[model samples]
Target chain A: MSGSLLITFDKVWKSYGQGEATVHALAGVDLAIRSGEFVAIMGPSGSGKSTAMNIIGCLDTPTAGTYSFMGIDAGRLDRNRRAMLRNLYVGFVFQGYNLLPRTTAVENVELPLIYRGAAARERHDLAMKALAEVGLVGREHHTPAELSGGQQQRVAIARAIVTRPTLLVADEPTGNLDTARTHEIMELLTRLNTELGLTIAMVTHEADVAAYAERTIRFLDGHVASDAVNLEVAQP
Target chain B: MIWETVRLSLLSVRRNVLRSFLTLLGIVIGVAAVIAMLTIGSGTTEKVKADISKLGSNLLVVRPGRPAGPGGPGGLDQATNPLGSKELAALVAHLSGARAISPASQKQVRVIFGTESLTSGVTGTDSAYLDARDWKLVSGRPFSDSEIRSGTGVCLIGETVRQQFFGAGDPEGEIIRVNRTSCKIVGLLEPKGYTGFGQDQDNVVLMPLAAYQRRIAGNRDIDSIYVAADDRTPTTELLPRVEDILRDARRIPPDREDDFSIRDMTQIADAMASATTTMTGMLGAVAGVSLLVGGIGIMNIMLVSVTERTREIGIRLAIGAHEKHILIQFLVEATVLSLLGGIIGILIGLALAGLASLTLAIPFAPSLAVILLAVGFSALIGMVFGFFPALRGARLDPIDALRHE
Candidate 1:
């Protein structure tokens, strides 16, 4: 049915605690995404959409069931293994655009390369290439404080792509941007997913942001309410 | 990698230069105090050792005592009071290791030379006294053995006595009088400032033993005897044997306490060395406590730094910049502060030590071990006080940290 699904979540359950204090952040969520697909997870404030994004990003583990990313069995991954998995295949972009403010745009992008112990020249070349891809080529020398909120988010995007990770995990990537900059950010993400054939999964509450993805998955309480292919996707 | 991390941390420090300098103040002062205290303490110990060694490490002092009376006729016995001419002759005859011995008497009296008059101490002994106490004549010569036996009214006056009696003039070979007796000064002794008891040693004159016994002490008995051991003998090995000889000379019965005392200069040296070591240890401890305070100051500022840069930690974490990287950055920053502080403190301490030596008229000597210990200790402080803050920064959650205001 699915051609070697890049990501597969099988009846996964994630809860906050034991007994009476257990917060059912996710309950029996099953999902699958093929290679090169762009999907958006949409939900209300109390829904488990963010939890699903965290699990997909390898920032957390599920209480029950199995998660396989790119045919790798990730359910029993240790801390080192999870870190290695995140480094090798997944890149995260937070809602707040968590770029180290003290670092310039290129240096911010160079951070993941540093973790990979890349040589200085290679790291610089890759970071600049990623920044240029996001259309921040000449602005690589500017720190986050010197950039606009949209520019900062773009730099975060540049950093996430620096290592050429297989999966791009964004949690409200354009939350702090205006409508125009939000469109610019969504356009950048769509181009990366389609043109570069990079698999992308994003979590958002904004209907307009969700419209950019080819598929939309909706959550209610702690379970998926509906999953459907977008009929009128606005992505590149 | 270390240098890169150092450079980054240094840049962070530069971002808030005033805060960084203020945070490092404690380290600087602590290091300086440690160096200063150690240098001065060592200088003091050095001065004491030099002075004590001047007493001639091989010298032994002896004094006569009354012999106990048998059922007490005149309340004295030959066994209690001895060590007279016979004991002296026996020691000089039998002990091959004995270099020389001086019989001595002391008197406090007034000295007059022409129109000059001064009250000073006078000692009566032979040539051996000069060698035993490491005394040398600055001018003229010491009294001959012929002069000592004939009770020749010749004297050797110390620097203070000469200055008092003759002012800037050469007092040696000049005639001076003690009480009512005329004596010519045959030698001028070099200055020996004071003893541990603050007694002025340079204000005395030396005369013949027989002259002092007949003219001043008015008795036949000598006050004390000073013995010098040969170069082939060591004070440590010779002391007990000499003690046994003195006990035998005094004729103390077996299993009995000897009446007279024998003082070896070696004991004085050991006691003084012990005291100085104790003082150095105490001062080092106090300086160590100040260094601890300095370390705490570093920790306090690092804690504030972590709190201030919460969002930075969050960002680094999100980028997969491992917890170890954050830990190393903060640790390196603190270590740099402490190391620089240590350097400055060492210089200041040595300067203080030099100043003390200059003012106190003692020798200034630097100690390398102390300096190295200070540097190492400061480095350790940086690590100990820096760990918790670095760990706190490393453990921050990417989500909460990114959200921190």
Candidate 2:
């Protein structure tokens, strides 16, 4: 919480290929965020919001310039070390709620812990705590298909936070939900933000979704178009 | 982690129970085919070896023919003596490793015992001939040397002949007749099962060599001579010396071919073993084609699995799984499937081999090494076929995968 900047993007650029036919995924973007901040990236389709989130999450690296997280140069880590960093430092929630279909809710939450070789009882305890945090205490046995859309997303969010990573990235967490479920998901995410002091980065095309965060960044054609604090924020 | 993948794969199989069972059927058939082919092949080989051993170890048969005179080559029969007596005597005298040699000259004649008469062989041979044919005295003893020298009225009876005359239990010292002449049955031979050529083994009688030379047939000429070699002398070390002595005795020039033939045990064994091994290999190759088809089945199932689990893979990769994790997961799944089939096949194969052996009345020989080899080979097939689809699954773009409808 005391750090000046938890993440720094110094003119980062990303391209899919080498030639004229290359896709300019993230074109010369520059940004920084301090610890304990909840930010939303707002953009239209093909506007590079997902690319920025991907680089910030350490799932991908920039093609040029530098991106640093917690002042440890990100690009310097090898492929395996980068993976280790992602496992240790970041958690992601995708739009699809990608909770392994055959797995129960608690088992989905335990996925990251399993990868780190946590003992069974310890992982189960942690996963139970995560499920309880998302108000899924009695629903541990439910699979993704067995739960409602918002409940499934909450299980996914529980999974994202089970490892207690410093950074949480959610991409369109409520895209599949109705308005009521969307509001519930928004409230849950915001509570995780202000209450747990987690540094959050999210991408959404909805204005209401962007208004739920303390800060919002706008992207257009692979560049940050605007950065502003929310004047009329929606609280959970 | 691999075990977890296997558990999940098993769970998935349970979820699609029918499809999974169908997929495994191919592997079952493939493994069963391999095991069955190997079992039958080895069983047949054992049967052949037993039949050959029944012919007697380290003995060769010499027949009078130029291979049955195929294109009317006008080859001679047993009367012509393609294997000569002089050469056989030389084999007994000069060959470094030979034990004895005796000629066979028989004229079909009526063998009588009181009023119980039968038409049977009147073959003539020396004492060494009986040893070459693996016969032993069941009662009394073989004809004496004096009897052989005098061409006396003494003969050795086989169990069959004695049983027909004396009803088996007490035929040791009995009397029989040959060509209407009374001869004393001085000995009875031990019972033997059957010949390599399927003739009844207990249907023969032995007469003194000089007795046959003088009494059985009027002509002084002999037909084929059976030669016996010492057991310690390998055929490789004996054939050339015997051939040289026989060549000298037959009065053939250095460059001219002799009018006789000689064969040995080692060549026959080598030839039979090689032919059987080759036939097994060829049959195994045919069975292997079904294994490849089973591999294709694995590939198809794996491709379907990858396509169906794309979103799960995307989430796993997003959550920190590297490409290798996904690869190992699917590879292990496929291997488990193949190994299950292998185990089932092994049990069935052993059962099948047992049944065949019981029916054929031969020894049941199941090698654990061969079973394990088949299992390992099937697992290898799974890995080879499953790798490509697993790579495709591991490399899917998370964004596109998550977005897949």
Candidate 3:
């Protein structure tokens, strides 16, 4: 695959509270990732991996230094502009699935398109395509409550990819699943990365989950402890 | 986008049916109360106007004394400043807009016919009295001009008097005694229900003024004069002319109040209407408070909803929903709730007003402007009260919200 930088962070700092109460969530972080690469962020609780992912997703901005997405300064965008950027370019899959309650899987997948002001017929067709991509074609009508944990996560993933975003960020997406379901979810992510050439940045504490990625960035005490490529997995 | 937001709002409302209904109840009561009060108030005004019209349009009652208690002018007593034939003649001569003028003198007398006797008022007036009071003859003719001039003992009996003395017999040509004076019944007056003053209009006998002066009243004094204005003339315009004429006829100085009073029936009708309108406004204002209460209730529920749906909002935000979209969604939901309440309240109000109007024997008059205003006002209330909560939902921090349990 051709390598082109998609996201870059230069000396980014994010701190919460003020003065003596301040806590550095992400301290002096610098990193760069290419398009179509699958990277896993590994850290202990409150080690700043989630904070970095947030800045990369444009859900947040670094308090100091510059964060850029596709050569544009993402940290300088206003709230509304940032929201538009996320709608057009970023998709998120949460650990809790976060599928809308009382809504069908297909409708949940249609959320991003709705914000994009897509016509109803097109939104429906695209949502069907997205659900089918995650092996959820026949289960579009089922609600989150009516499905198993794995199926719910699949619906969440379908919602994430419905916009055909350039980047899909997953925050411990398999944290709530059992071992078999976790393997199934990781395989789905890998397949999306390989076949669609989609850029993925995932946060997880499990070593095996990080092993599935082409590269891993481990964080310790709000700083990047290690950034290395995995040579074991053969490149296409 | 708006349609989708509406759909979402409707779905959320449906999910919490009981809470939604309870919140809307306040608005329902408010709108219903306002409509019902105004409707009933208008109906009562209509009834009063109808009652006044029954007394005949553009007619003024001239009494020697001021009309007493909450209705007419004051000062002077009837016993001392009584009117006579001269005053009647002056009214006929000096007034330009008067259609008819008739002087009346009344005396309570007992009438007997065919061994049946009933005590009733004997009113002495000429042929012009019928036109002035707008009375009609049900059977037989009114007294002839010659009969009135000659003081003939022929009289017209009202329906109540006929009922009391005739006993199903034809009393048109029968003789009856008015306190020992024999009189032939020339005609029967039409039924006139009740007067606004609660007096029965059909419980009297009408006779020629000359005959009444000679026999029933035993005096040449006329108690009052009834003046009917010309068709094109308004009573308000005719009143001042009559007052001036009376003042000149009675020889009263311009600096002093008149020795008599003129009561305009239309003015009384207008006063009653305005009073009811004020009361209706007050009632509607009181009811409007409940709409505010209902609006507050909506805000309360919406705040709780925002808190409960914090994570959902965070998910939506993370998925790329604008702040304004969330704000509009909640605003529309609140408006829908209030609008539903408003529509139902209108229906209930109409039904209640109809029932009240029927029971009170008044006309049902629902104002379309008022209904539209109420609907608009309720929608406004929803927007005003729903704003803060929707703003809170819109401005939530995505990270913190998504982390909310």
Candidate 4:
């Protein structure tokens, strides 16, 4: 059964600059992602995939048309209000594994909760649980520099889920990983999507990465080129 | 939440120890200058007040001159008539509210005892000189009234003179030659140490006015008259009376200015103390300018730090950190850094002040209020200078910042 829509974009347009030099990043893009769905966004550079992901995560607002999240017109909200929405509902994992350098893994995971005004003890416990879920229990005290690429990515994932956010926005999460590490990270993400029914919108260029998602959306020339279900992949 | 932010800032500060210390140097020197100047200034003020008090309390000095004006030579005026025994006798007889009236004239003369010879200030006055000056004798007795009237060669030697000629032996009954005349020592004057002007107060000898005029000065001109006010009288109230008595004793005409000047020691004390306070304030203000420069230094470094940590700011923002959070974090970092500099500066400053006090022979006076104000001011400087850079960091666009290398 299809779940209710958690994100919707109705002809969303994001433009840069003004007048003749203007470039449209997202041109009248329309898309919908349901709760509990793992969607992969595929496109070449400047194909509006990253722009759509930013809009979905509430990091940026559309220049025209509506971008709604859960039941709210998020594009119309102010920067601080959008920041609050993002903090409450969205988590981000970046290609660079953007955990703060020189900070312990557990401390990095507690960062989002710090902004949430969580008490120290409660934040520590939640961060510990999140780290354990990411299979980084023994490396909680290791800094990013001390951890390997895969381990650092796992810490980033722990940080992303520490707040138990409703949606996870991952941009090229496995782009820097090797073949084996990529498979391991993909399996961990798939298990999270199935067991927790967490909504995930990941941006990636690889075909195998897209196949791991339940649905794949392709963009070209600032518009959605195609959307299809991955029928060959086994359902959870 | 504040504690977490503070901890984060501390970690950031510690990450670059050398840079942090260099950034703090300006504040340290500024605070140290302020503390040292203020502490030494107050100590000098105390020394000046103490020196003035040592001259005498409730006392006035009548000198034979017009009051000195700016750029003009001070003390005795060459054109005016010198005070003599007539002025002294006039005050002793006509002036009321005066506890004692004594006249003194001084000259530097070589004194010889056996093979040892030293230059000494020889002062001539009456038996009442000790009472008027608030001076005491360590041993023996002051000159008798008969000795003062008859010009006997009896004199009292100060501690410095006794140390030079007697070498810790008893000076009483010992005869010392004063400018070719031999005088017998009757008493040992108590030690008064040195004045703030570095003038030695105990390197002299005291004798009767009659003996000094007859044997040493060979003249009856008195240099100054010492008038001490009674217990119930204020110097301000006693000043005019002495002036009137002196004018009449000299028979100064009503149309002309008086030939003598009477100075109140209490007034001079107040003026000197106020001058010292003004000097201290000026030094402190100059030091305050350095603190401003130090604050600007903080602002410059904080701006550079914000630029360097743009990506970190983006990471925090992406995870939902508010603008105020970023602003407060930088502000706290700057404050903690400046406060640490202030503490170190205080210690160094006090040590410098203590050393100065030891060398200059002034009291070591450290004021609590000044130290507290320095602490508060350094913190305020951090907040004020840190505001602009912090605002810049807080206003950065998350996407743009994240894209920064």
Query: Each model's TM-score, in the order given?
Result: 0.78, 0.74, 0.84, 0.94
lDDT of 3 by residue, B1-405 (tens): 778887888888788889888888888888898889888887877777777777766889888875466755464554558888888999888889888898888878888876888888899999999998788998999989999899999999988887887656677898888889999998998888665456777888989999999987778888888999998899989999999888899998888766787889778778877887788788878888877888888889888888999999899899898999889988898888888788888999989999998776678999999899889988998888889999999999888889999
lDDT of each: 0.81, 0.78, 0.88, 0.91
**Candidate 1, which CAPRI tier?**
acceptable
Candidate 1's C-alpha runs over 4 A off are A1-4, A101-106, A135-143, A179-184, A228-236, B1-46, B64-95, B106-122, B144-221, B236-257, B278-314, B321-405
Residues B69-107 of candidate 1: C-alpha lDDT, one tens digit per residue: 462333224654634655666566555576677777787
Q: What DockQ does each candidate score versus the true complex, computed on alpha carbons? A: 0.32, 0.38, 0.65, 0.71
State, as a TM-score between 0 and 1, how close model 1 is to the true structure. Answer: 0.78
Per-residue lDDT of candidate 2, residues B1-405 (tens digit): 666778867777777777777777777777777777777777767766766655556665444444333454434654344554566667677766655566777766788877887666677776777777566887788767788668787878777787777783676567677876667777778887554346666777778766776767766666666556668877677766766776677666897654555667547766786677689778878878888898889889989988998887777777777778778888887777777767776777678778877776556877777788889988988899889998898778665676676
Name the lDDT value of residue A35 in candidate 2: 83
Off by over 4 Å in 4: A232-236, B69-79, B162-175, B184-186
Candidate 1 chain A weakest lDDT stretch, 10 residues: A75-84
Count of clashing residue pairs in every prediction: 12, 0, 0, 0
lDDT of 4 by residue, B162-237 (tens): 9998879999999999989999999999999999999999998999999899889999999899999999999999
lDDT of 2 at A120: 82
Q: Using DockQ as the measure, which candidate wins?
A: 4
| Model 3: per-residue Cα lDDT over A1-117, one tens digit each | 356999999999999999999999989999999999999999898899999999999999999989999999999998888999999999999999998899999999999898899
If you assessed candidate 4 against the hidden native complex, which CAPRI class would it receive? medium
- C-alpha-based local distance difference test score of model 4: 0.91
